[model samples]
Target: MPGQLFCFGFGYTAEHLAARLLPLGWKIAGTAREADKRAAMQAQGIDAHPFPLPDPAQALAGVTHILSSVPPRDGHDPVLAAHGGTIAALPDLVWAGYLSTTGVYGDAGGAWVDEDSPLNPSSPSGKARVAAEAEWQALDLHLHIFRLSGIYGPGRSAIDQLRAGTAKRIARPGQLFNRIHVEDIAAALAASMAHPNPGAIYNLADDEPASSSDVVSHASTLLGVAPPPEIPLEQANLSAMGRAFYAESKRIRNDRIKRDLGLTLAYPTYREGLAACLSGAVSN
Candidate 1:
């Protein structure tokens, strides 16, 4: 049955999910921080509203499913802090989802991490996610947690970076990063909604984990442009956030999503994902 979904943060991944569900006779509504973004979502038939809604109970009166993609601020999840009680009290709520990051596993030294892996986030942002996940789990809702890898699709892929002259080939030995196309993320979320399992944590990632430089080179090849010069990570002029991203080297294992949700990723690897992005095969 199609049910109304309320996403706490209707950003990139959430928008893709909404696109998939809308065609199936599902009603989509969510919160957007910006007025322009809210207007845009409202124009697309979403019951858009600002964050920290003044009356969340009224806004989410008939919502059956909820998804929170909002990251934590200062070690706290804003959504849960503001509206967790109202969400927990929703009489018709069936399923809830929290979009987390694989960084919760921290640096596994390029080792593969599964859902059973311990949380050992290294960065401050990652630590905040860990805290937020804990808070969400404590709530009295049928919640599923998704620890996503690097997200890229459509205008957010390396193709855009290369075209904009921001693509970099940073060489770091023994460093591999897992990534999932945004479309695949949406598919996985939909699959989970179909097979609602409370208290389940799944990793959303692709089959292959490769170096950042390799992805950039492949994107350049697809664009028929010269690849950026390979530079050592130590010498690369990366911001603190970029440096933090490179600090972790672990491959995420996504067996649970397939085994439990019965999902088969359309773009199994970066090759197919990038090709789809280049050909405009996604809904974005």
Candidate 2:
């Protein structure tokens, strides 16, 4: 079915998601926070609107599906809060997807975490996300949670960081990291959109989980340059928020997405994603 979809906090992920969904003959609407971005969205020829959650207008009226790309800020998501009951009341809305992070599973010490893993978020952001998910799930609406890994895509890849001299090689002692290209996440989102499963939870991570240093090092290698010097976790200059992310580690599994969605990852690991992007294999 060609569903009418609305994407809240439609930023990077939603942008790519809209590209895929639009082609599949779905009616798509997205949100941009900034007025400048709204104008930019118009220039890009995408129907990106501007709105906040927790008190959404009639937008959810007939929305058959919705994807929330916005993360919880300060324990409140206006969009989700405002429309929780309203959305639940809408019989047409089949699936409501929340793009959460595996950080909710907390620092598993590189242990594997599936959908059944108990949430033990170590960071404020992750805790807020978990709270937000709970709020949505309590709505008695069709809900799905997609726990995303580190996101990378064209123009947002590690090469951009390298060129800008902002790349980090944070050595946090065997801190395993997972990633997924924007396109792959977008494809996975589409698969879920087409095949909506109520209350589904899927981990959207790359097949290969490498250490932080390994990923940056590999990206530098693909670009034919020495990697940025490693900065020990203690010595690294990071904001409280950024540092919080380094405090936890988990090797997320994507078996549920693959098995349920019948999908295969294009970039199973950072090597493939970076190699292809650095080599200009991905089009802008």
Candidate 3:
């Protein structure tokens, strides 16, 4: 039978996953915060509706898979709060996925952390994710949680930042952050669907972990332009969320995704990822 996938948040990551599954005859439905975005998705043949799920039972009637990319707001997961009962009661549901951030591992002193790492989220958002993860686990379903690293893709990568002249080389010594290409994220999700493991937690991150300044420099080089001047972490002016990103430094281990799911990343490092984005732009 063809799969019916419903996403709680049809943002960048979910869109990539949907694109991959659509070719395989999957029926995709999702929620958008704004009516305009929902209409836009409907225009593209997607059954997207404004969130808070108007008709929970009706909307999730034939949904075999559920993917939640919505972040916790005010210490609550909107999806669970709104339609937890409806989703739990769905007899047709097989796989349930929640998108989490690697920040849940907190500051690891630049050390390697895996699925077994103790979650000690430092920022407010990270703390909320920890809470949401626990909440989702309480539901009796085939739940699979993914702790994603910094997400970057074609329109949302260092290449775009550098080209837009908004890229900043923030120098934070010993700060190694892991990142995952959006395509790789979609690949991993698809792989999990092929081999469903209930209660499994996977870290979705690239093999290489580098500093922000290094990524900026590499992106500038790819664009054939001088990199932005380096700004020391102490002197850099950043919003609360932005500064919180640098507060945690951990190299996430992705061996579980490879070993268990039998999957390999297409862009294993920032170099390949940035280069691909640049080439893709040129070709387009």
Better of 1 and 3 by lDDT: 1
lDDT of 1 by residue, 1-284 (tens): 99999999999999999899898899988998899999999999999989889788789999999999999998999998999889889999999999999999999999999999999999888899999999999999999999999999999999999999988999998899899999999999998898899999999999999999999999999999999999999899898878999999998898988899998989889999999989998733
Worst 10 residues of 1 by lDDT: 275-284
Instruction: List, residue by residue over 96-173, the lDDT tens digit for candidate 2.
Output: 888988888889998888889999988888899889888888888778898999999888888888988999998888
In model 1, which runs have C-alpha deviations exceeding 4 angstroms? none
Quick one: ranking by TM-score, best first?
A: 1, 3, 2
Q: Hey, what RMSD does candidate 3 come out at?
A: 1.8
Query: Considering lDDT, where higher is better, how would the candidates rank from best to worst?
Result: 1, 3, 2
Clashing pairs in 2: 53-78, 53-79, 54-78, 54-79, 54-82
Error of 3 at 75 (Å): 0.7
TM-score winner, 2 or 3: 3
Q: lDDT of candidate 3 vs native?
A: 0.91
TM-score of each: 0.98, 0.93, 0.97
